[model samples]
Target: MRNGNRRGKPVEKARHFWPTTKRLISYLRPWKWGVLLSILMAIVSVALNIVSPKILGQATTDIYDGILKGVQQMKLGLHITKYPIDFNHVGQICLIVVALYILSGLFSFGQQVLMTWISQKVVYNLRQDFKEKMGRLPIKYYDQHSNGDLMSRMVNDMDNISGTLQ
Candidate 1:
């Protein structure tokens, strides 16, 4: 029985990757708008995250430049008339960077929620289809295959697919 089970195991390799992917993507047709919006949110979130670091770098550069200017004035024996560092400008930059990060986080959260909702819907539809198909199979088919294996495929495999989609 063990040797027979080993021989009956499903193949691991995909015979047609692109076609399979296209077929899988077909399931997302009903939620196409949600998918598109989720993708856009992901793009915007990544862009904001990428830009925040450069904005921070600007604040660092400004501080370094101000310190160098102050040191040069001291070397020349000039009286200090004002503070070298521009605190207001640095503060504004900090605020902008913080805002960008917040926006990025919000977008990321929204994308995650949208994706979870979409994946659940897809899985729900798939389960319905599976149930309907199983009902249509002949009695002889049930007699040929192990009932435990069929149940595992119907339940456990679906759960695995749901996790992958998410």
Candidate 2:
């Protein structure tokens, strides 16, 4: 038999999360633009990557078709297309794809930097509020509570929260 009780542990009651989530969102309301811009850039990046495959495929198809046309005209004396392979056009498409991805990466990087700034500002505000609350609390409250526990509540707990956010 196991040393400990067979029943592992008691299940805790589940807490409703939406209200807390809404409160957090309310805190972020001030930097709505930062969050919104991050989301928008993410959308743009996805769009660019999605369109890239099609453009690349077009360039690939052009190369293959041009090769086939050249072979047919030379071997069978058949004219598939009047013009030869359009290297210039394929080169332009490749350049466009590269530019689009670069822009997407830049936007994504900017969004991450902006969001990091906003999150730090919010964290600073929250910690400052906790400090202020500690100052305002009654002397009796501190006298009754363990100093170490209270300090941990203020510092360690907040650090945990900040870590979770990050």
Which one wins on TM-score?
A: 1
- Cα RMSD, each candidate: 5.0, 5.8
Q: Which pairs in model 1 have colliding backbones?
A: none
Question: Candidate 1: lDDT of 49?
Answer: 100
- The lowest-lDDT stretch of 10 consecutive residues in candidate 1 is 1-10
Local accuracy of candidate 1 as per-residue lDDT tens digits, 13-128:
65797996796688889999999999999999999999999999999998999988988998899878764998889999999999999999999999999988998998888888
Candidate 1 residue 8 Cα shift, in angstroms, is 18
lDDT for position 126 in model 1: 83
Please report the candidate that would top lDDT against the real structure.
1
Q: Give the per-residue lDDT digits (tens) of candidate 2, residues 1-166.
A: 3444457655545367788668667778999987888889888888888888888888899899888778878788665655478999899989998998898888778767777787777778878877898899999998999978877766765565555544
